[model samples]
Target: MTAPTLFHVAILRTLLIVAALVALESNRLEAAAPEPTQKIASAAAAFLDTLDDTQRGKVSFAFNDAAQRIRWSNLPVSMAEHRGLRMGDLKANQRDAVMNLLATTLSKMGYEKVVGIVESDEVLRKQSPKGAPPFGRDEYFISFLGKPSATEPWMIQFGGHHLALNITIAGEQGVLTPSLIAVQPAKFTLDGKTIRPMGRETDKALELVQALTDEQRKQAILGSQMRDLVLGPGHDGETIQPEGLKTSTLNEAQRKLLLELIAEWSGIIHDTAATAKLNEIKANLADTWFAWSGPLEAGKAYFRIQGPTVIIEYAPQRLGGDVTMHIHSMFRDPTNDYGKKFAGK
Candidate 1:
């Protein structure tokens, strides 16, 4: 080969420098944006490492086991409705490891909400009537649907009386639908502070309902009472007819209120997943429907928001003949429950 001229040599050096700069920039971006799925899997493995063999037996299950995947309920463990490793069985260190795993899977706000819900259950235990099932912070169970892997699908199912957080991870995406959160003795004093676990969900929903016009109210109010969530627990992959008022008919202010109401549920997951869900709902806003039942007043009521891929329901339980003090609510994605997209179902 002929030796390059000075001009050719200079051009070659410039191209080489440009290539190096591009490679460095790519590496920086890659390092900065680690896959969240890997973080979740690492956290999950760390948690499992802290468990003894016997505890592992209780916490681990086949990912494809359909029964185990659906083996969660709002009822207390004393009711014999759920199975997994109970939080009470874990040592303090082990419990902290579990919380770390949850932190990896949820946003800060979402993590706080989960902790609040569990703590509220402790309050419920104190106020339960005679013969009621055992209720407390430690009554919650945590289980892994499959072996944790950065590239594979798995689930983290944690729940107890009045709370169930079913978080599914499929590659880079995470789904927090098919989760239930409720509270009994809804308002309680703890450490000299009042705590209501589902307060935002209740209040935001009521605010939206109250903002409706007379005609909007007529279209949105249900003729019959909704005593409980239509898609709670075992009712996964179910669909409900869009009832009540459609979002397309609502004024811009009313529609904004509706979005805020939906966020109270969607915001319970990590921000990335929550943002994806909220955008999905917003894209389908025109098709979304809102329905209400019972007294529209502040203390007690039932409401539902249903759309193409989302479903949210709030129902107050009549336990102890006090409708206002007990509540049940759920968030579900009909098309993506259990991370069906990642499962290739």
Candidate 2:
């Protein structure tokens, strides 16, 4: 072969080799993505099976891994509205047993926060709109990536109507923030009781905004209140910016309030690990932005706190089937988007 021709062939070979390496890495990353429901669904089903016949009876006829994708509206966990999978279904004693089951599952998953929120939900569900189902009655699906457990690295996600919790344990350097928590009240009544769900989380956020000396309010409030969470379902992993609120301008009091606001938000997590994540968010609070829109009232308003540590959003919507008020909220982590297992950054 000619000398020039030989050099050209070598160049082509190098390009092919580079392309091949890129393709291989891309495929590997794709495979590393998380798969939650399928992995834990069987175990969830088995756990349900282990329940005594009486306990199983408390579960909605529709409850099970197979029913993971039911229409959000057709939720079965709400008892009075859908008339299934509720505390009433369980004898008082069995209710605690049910908690035990959930706790076991979380331990098996290597995190108790999973059950912590469940317990919190149980409280909220009791206060669900009369003639309606449990709050966040939608399925609690579990997903996973590589099984690093709490030891190596892994992610487990549990979400529904008003809750979005993602725990990414990447060795000891893990992140459970960027978490989301939401609650809704129909007409502001709870569990046939008049309690308010999320009232504290919401109140604290506004209190912090209000405490901001008048000038700080102008920066923190960020225009008008929103009618709904600006970033909704399909908008997942999409962040909004030049980010209206920044922690840069705030008084010592306002900064403390910011931590207070985050504290209220993080209080929902039932696990120490989740709480530790909240504290990290608190520690990084100054690096985050607190933004709210609309009237910060019980009716017709929305808010969000987005920063390096966590993203919390609150929205009000028309009640489903009943006239009670509605709310949709979520918490997402900065580094934990999708899952950090394969996310090299």
Which one wins on lDDT? 1
List ranges where model 2 is wrong by over 4 Å: 1-98, 101-159, 169-180, 186-194, 296-300, 319-324, 338-345
For model 1, the stretches where C-alpha displacement exceeds 4 angstroms are 1-34, 129-131, 224-226
Best candidate according to TM-score: 1
lDDT (tens digit, per residue) of candidate 2 on 1-345: 656687899999999999999999766654553333223333444445555765455442321222221222213334212222444444455445445534533333323333434445555567657875445433453333343232334443445445444544443333444444444443243346454555555567667766766665666565564656655544545776635467877778877777776655555433444456667776776678876666645435566777775777777666543212455666566556544533343
State TM-scores per candidate. Answer: 0.87, 0.57
> lDDT score of model 1?
0.84
CA-lDDT, candidates in order: 0.84, 0.51
TM-score (C-alpha, index-matched) for candidate 1 = 0.87
Per-residue lDDT, model 2, residue 330, is 60
